[model samples]
Target: MSATIKDVAKMAGVAVSTVSYALNNSPKISEETRRKVVRAAEALNFRPSGAARNLKKRKSETIGLFLNDLGGPFYSQVIEGVQEIVASHDYNLIVCSTYGGENSSAHRFLREKFVDGAIIMGTAISDSLILQVASESFPIVVLDRELRGDYVHNVLITNEQGGYDAVAHLIKLGRRNIEFLSGPSAAFDNTQRYEGYKRALLEHDLPVPKRIAMHGRFLEAGGYQAVKLLLASKRLPDAIFAANDEMAIGAIRALHEAGLRVPEDIAIVGFDNINLAPLIRPALSTIGHSKFEVGAIATQLVFNARKEEDVIILPTQLIARQSCGFSGGVSEQDHDNLVASILHVGGRTKH
Candidate 1:
């Protein structure tokens, strides 16, 4: 049989009300008496029910972290940032990937008020649903998308600027025939990035080759397949700008297998500056931002008491490596030394 609060009170030689106050850390009880009650409860192996405590306090002290999918290295750093902030705030975080937004668990948790708030990063959950559920009592913070509601806040990266900088760097390297490997058509980030790419090309009076603009789906395999299709067409561009680093790496592998060299035959640039970008051969020249900061800031917004809708846009910077053939007229050794020096000086390049 399980020990009850009465048993703890009896064991500690205290009244039932005194036991309650002690266990709940009420100021009405002395510290010494609270310690005594706690010791008795521990000795009796009395575990307080979380559901009961939540009901009494009317606060779950938990938050939900919703993602599109859990199978990428990109999410790990973001999760770390969220976890750090949530822990510091004395709240538990539940991570759920909706896998295209059909996750019953996510739906249940949100509807049932199992969490105090949610930090949502996936697109599967419709904006209508978020708007319906978000109230002043149940605030929500959305990442990567712009959502406006009384209780909703948005945290997003400057994806358009990142995309523009990436393409502009390629154009500055004298590559006019630049191809863009796009991500999913439904993704807002992809749309913004493509818009930026188009804007840069238009500014430079470069032709936007509609035929070469292929979808990479933001995956390595997608990039590889897209490159294969481009090769099959027998019409290659002077350079390619993949929407993400994973696609860029995949394109590099595919180009190498087809007896083409990067930055010589076809220069390449990518966005997202993922961890593997620097480690890869002919290190990726890409747009970089702190995914960790994005996660942390989003989580913080969820906890904020401001009822008005707000938007936070994080900035991004361009990271130049060897892949884009922009050595600035320096020798290969000198360029490498310069890159090392930049890294040592704490520039945007990832370690």
Candidate 2:
């Protein structure tokens, strides 16, 4: 059997409390006594229990990060940003996926306070659960969702304005019959982008499509299938705005297979300027934002050490690449225009 603290105490001819104080380097025990206890522990190969130490201090020195899934290139930068902050503070980062909702290990971590604080990035975890668990002592930083609570800080992306600008750009290029390819209806980001799509059409006096594509998986395959179905309808829109780059890439593939040309026959735009967006043929016009900054800011909020409810909304930029066939790329003048538009929309400045 393995040696325990009792074994060390007996071996050193000292009390169990003396053994603990010696091991923990308590000042109550003399340096000579500490050395003697340490020698005994080393002889017996006695190691302290981390769980016991944590229970004593009431601290784990760990941070929990809840994500939808660790798929695609989207989370790499976010994780890096989070790691940068976590490593500096000497804290361990535990990333978990909420793929199974309440039954998932991630949800259990949230419910049980497995870490000192939490950074939530997905909608799989319910709002009620978050509100119930968040307290003044146990703060939470949520990304892309707006939920008000005593110690909940929300870090949001400027989705609505980004969406508006993307669709408005298409409308200005004379693509009136624009089709909005959407993700899950309940998704906050998706809903906000779709709202911008509708607003652009309404502002320009264009008829919004009575029926639109819905329930995208926000993956490449989901984009492909949605476009294929739209093609079958025999009514193709002049422009397609996917809620994300993956879906837009999928739509391009579907259109290519059907012998339709991009921008010449149909224009396309996407959100989230993922790395793959620029590498793809014809390139993808996308709404770009600093995902790394989002992760970093959210983590900083977790360590704010106050009960003030804070909200940080990161600004999004419109990247005009080859797909939209507008200007092929954004010029300095266009960048100036983008800043003006963003200011007009909500006065959000970059961090």
Candidate 3:
């Protein structure tokens, strides 16, 4: 059998309480007694149980990160940033997907206090659940939705501005018949982006024909299916603005299969300058932001000592590429240089 605290106390000829105080480094225990207890524990190969220690102190020294799903290139940089910050602070990170909703392992982790705090990145988990658990003194940082609560904070990107910029870019290129490929209707980012698209259209005196707007579910398959449906109608928009790069890429594939060329027959723009956006055929013009920074900031907020709620909004920038039919009046050499610069920064290369 393994040695316990009692074994250490008996070996050190001290009381069990003294062993506990010494092991925990209590100031009440003298230096001599602490050293003696340490020596006894080493001699007996006694290792304290992490569960017992955490139970006593009510701190797990760990944080949980919840996402909708774990499949995608988009999450790579974000996860890296979160892991870096968590490790720097000497804490462990537990990543879980809340796709299972109430029965998700992440939900159980939160309920059982397996982590000190949590960073949520998806809408699959309800705000009501977050508010209820956070009300009990647990800190939560939500990345997908904004919630007002004493213990709930938000880290979000300027999605509305991104959407406006995309549609406005298409408008500047003389594309009046533009179509919107949207994500899930319930997504906060999707709603914000849709608002921006509408604002830009209204400002430019452009018509937002209801027939041209379609839901893409933020997935490549959704984009492909939506485009196929549009093709069946025998009417194609001059430009398409997908809410995300994945959907944009899907739309590109669907267009190619339909004997149409990007930026020649139909221009396209997307949000979230994902790693593959610039490498795809014709290249994708996109709204760019540092997903790594978003993750880092969210993790930092969860670990912050402040007891008040905080909200952070990260900025976004527009990246023009061939997909938008805007080459910035640059020569072929200059375009090559621009691509090289983007590749250098993103650590990717054309295949």
- TM-score leader: 3
Error of 1 at 301 (Å): 1.2
What candidate 2 gets wrong by more than 4 Å, as runs, is: 1-49, 328-351
Global lDDT scores for all candidate models: 0.83, 0.85, 0.84
- Residue 28's lDDT in candidate 1: 97
State in Å the error of residue 136, model 3.
7.9
Query: What global local distance difference test value does model 2 have?
Result: 0.85
**Which pairs clash in model 3?**
none
In the range 1-351, model 2's lDDT, one tens digit per residue, is: 889999999999999999988887899999999999999999999888988888866788888889998897888878887888889898899998899879998899888988889999879999999899898667898888889888998989989988998999998788888999898778899989999989999999998888766445788899999999989989888899999999999999999999999989999999998889889987889898777677877888888856878888878878888788966446434755765565346444433
TM-score of 3: 0.89
Candidate 1 residues 1-351, lDDT tens each?
Answer: 999989999999999889878889999999999999999999999987787778778889998998887875678878887887899899999998786345567877777778889988868888988888897668999988988888998888889988898888888889888898988888888888888889999999987876545788888888998998898889898899898888898899989999999889999988887889888888888877777777777787788846887787776767778899764433334534554554345333111
lDDT tens string, model 3, 90-185? 889999999787899898887776888898988988888887788434689998588878778888888999899889888888899888998989
List the candidate 1 regions with Cα displacement exceeding 4 Å: 1-3, 9-47, 328-351
TM-score of each: 0.84, 0.84, 0.89
